[model samples]
Target: MEDRKQALVSRLLQYALIHEVLGIPYNEIVIKRTFEGKPYLECSKVGVEFPNFNFNVSHHGDYVAIASEPLCLVGVDVVCCTEPEKEPVPEFIENFSSYFSSLEWDNIINTGTSDEILVDFYRYWCLKEAFVKAVGSGLAYGVDKVEFHHTNWTNISVKVDGEPLTEWRFWLFKLPERHWVAVARGHPRFATENYKRTICKAEFDAEEYHKGLNLPNVAFVTRIIEQLIPVSHGEERPTMQDICSDCLHLSSREA
Candidate 1:
């Protein structure tokens, strides 16, 4: 499982760079761990300059999720939603009550159906996990410290230490039929108007990964790059040509 998770992260990192999301080469990218055990990318290990990028990875059951943003903190988590038939719903909630906030506990107990309770349990679990991972504090920053309130499936508000936090944007969606995934990104003014989601499944094979690199979806890559680049005051936004030229120059220098 660990090996598979690492492979998934590596592939996503390569995709981010190859598509000009970070303007760095695959070989130059080095994975480093923070004091809290979160993985991040650096290029200094290979004498290349580090680019502005933040990414997080999580895996469960048979799925792995990766999230990246050019200049903002990003975290992603995937949880297997397959419920075991043997465990009673109440017993399951009781076993995991320590991880839930008081409000979450109330919701789970008040939910009308066992299935609803299970769904709510995983939804809150993924949101909290994604938030902590975004802060790069991992579980050391207690999950109980943060609580999520949803006005709708897509609209959410958060509270940390019981104070409302308005700087984060969250996305929650199901991955095919087997897993639930959540992504969190933080900015003082976060908006979901530009947010997009893509889902794909690939096996962790080095040879296949290398082959896949030669076939990036240009339109999709360009769209993501445009969304990730930050706008500056009184300056024109970058064109796709400008971004591609910069990446080409970097690649030539590396060559």
Candidate 2:
């Protein structure tokens, strides 16, 4: 019952946000999931033609987040910090060192506190997950192949196999309740290839994607459950959005 409720609410959030963004009726909105479970909006039928208009959702601990882009493929991830009780922090994190690059691993261990170390580990993990998800790959991605470089989790960049991927963008936030959230945006070619194998492929142009200079920044907006609930009688309400229109909008509430 709990799982079903969670699933139902997730659908409600997805549909509500899609409706808000596309300004179209729910009947006309078509969201098809990849075999890997990444939900994408089918904008062609509605005459909305953004080459890589896509979104991704993630939930952890006490929050659910959705990140969308009109030109770039977007992915988001949230993780609650948890410290291991039995194993030493270094030993516990070392076991998963293969998932991170040497530089990333070094930074993760160089932290001063055990708590900081754990947070650092989760931060990188979340970033990697967001990047892969944006690229249309699931968590079972070549995570170690790409490394993130950041300053206090902002002004971030990434390198794949020691070469900078200049087109990619990333943002991170320390959410309420000690959770870390990461958002990633990148080219649609890498995103559409893996997910569209079993579905209707999205039409994306590299030039148009790169030409899309105005990407949205990440926003952690607080919303009530009532807002996510659909209104009856076909009534309508004013749309509430963040200032950075094209970025990720994350709504977090107590579970």
Candidate 3:
């Protein structure tokens, strides 16, 4: 019940954000999920037209994050760095070791003290989550196949099956509250094509996404629950589809 409640809250926040960004009325904002359960707006059904505008929502600990862009697909994740309560860090991380590449696991374990290791582990986890979310993959996505390559945790790029994905971009930011946030942005068609069995036949303007690379480094401004509440609900709720019509119906294949 608690998990459902939080999910509802996050869903409402997503609706509220779209209202604020695109100037759509709260009652007119329509949201639906992909077969993989990634939320998106069906612009045509919603009476709006924009080229490949996409957004994603995530919440963890005390923060909820949303990343949206018209040029590229975007995913955001927030992870709170907290010590394990039931087991040591190594043990806890071991349970998830299968999700990481051998190289990534080596980097995590070799990193400095226990606290630093915990942070590093969460960083990798956060990045993985962000990438999957960006690509609209659900729980079945093979996180192990997509590996993030970084030098000293900087200059983030991703590789799938040992080949580099040059068009995708990643960024990680540390908050003052021992929390880490990661963002993943990639060309919409490229993002979809890379997903096994998924196809994007629509002509794309890759140049637009690249030209916008001059986009300023965005900083998260805190929005308390109260400030968000007003937009979270509206007098009349619009009908929404359970699954997005615009999303491809491709089934996920194992890596």
Candidate 4:
């Protein structure tokens, strides 16, 4: 499972960095790991600094997710919405509730239904993971230190180290099915509403190397590649409606 997870994440990263971000083929990009084991692109190969390019990858259950931003730090996470087959929902929530803050626990209980509770659990879990990954500490930072308050699904407030943080924002939405995705990014470059989420379901033929890999049916990856390059609007300035017209068209298809 670990090997398969790494391979899938690498494939997604390659596609995202080479085709999406760099506008180059996969062969031209060189990837290196940081001292902390985080993967980053070797910008010198492209003859550009690429100081603003940042990305993060995560996989849980059957899903793998990747997020990238041209000029801001970005982190993303995806998780299955159902509990493990070995444990029931009540028992699973009881076991994991201690890891969440008091308000998070209350939010779960207020969900009222078992299915709703399960979804909420994964929602909070993904958000916490995304935030930690955005900070570049990964799990070593301990998710318990941060708390999330969601006034609504899209509107959220984060408190880390017992203080409110205004420079960060989060987005929570469902993919196609059976999964939830969350994103965390820095301020000024992108707003919460500007972030677009989509479900990309693509199959990679790994039968030659790995016979059985548990790949998810739905993958939640960002569409930030389109934002990296500037679009030319002949003479006249493009309206915000003209920019996000495609997004608005796809909004109806989102789950």
lDDT winner: 2
Kindly report which residue stretches of model 1 are placed more than 4 angstroms away from their true locations once superposed. Answer: 1-20, 44-52, 187-255
Score each candidate by Cα lDDT. 0.57, 0.70, 0.69, 0.58
Off by over 4 Å in 3: 1-5, 45-49, 191-202, 231-255
Model 4 C-alpha RMSD to native: 15.9
Candidate rank order under lDDT: 2, 3, 4, 1
TM-score for each predicted model, relative to the true structure: 0.65, 0.81, 0.81, 0.66
CA shift at 246, candidate 4, in angstroms? 36
Q: Compared with the true structure, what per-residue lDDT tens digits does model 3 show for residues 30-122? A: 666555667677554323244566777776665667787665667888888989999998898899998999999999999988888899999
When sorted by TM-score, best at the front, the candidate numbers are 3, 2, 4, 1
- In candidate 3, residue 180 scores what lDDT? 88
Lowest lDDT block of 10, candidate 4: 193-202
With candidate 3 superimposed using the best TM-score fit, by how many Å does residue 250's alpha carbon deviate from the native?
22
Model 1 TM-score?
Answer: 0.65
User: How far is 155's C-alpha from truth in model 3 (Å)?
Assistant: 1.2
Per-residue CA lDDT of model 2 for 20-61, tens digit only, reads: 777666555566666566776666643445444567777777
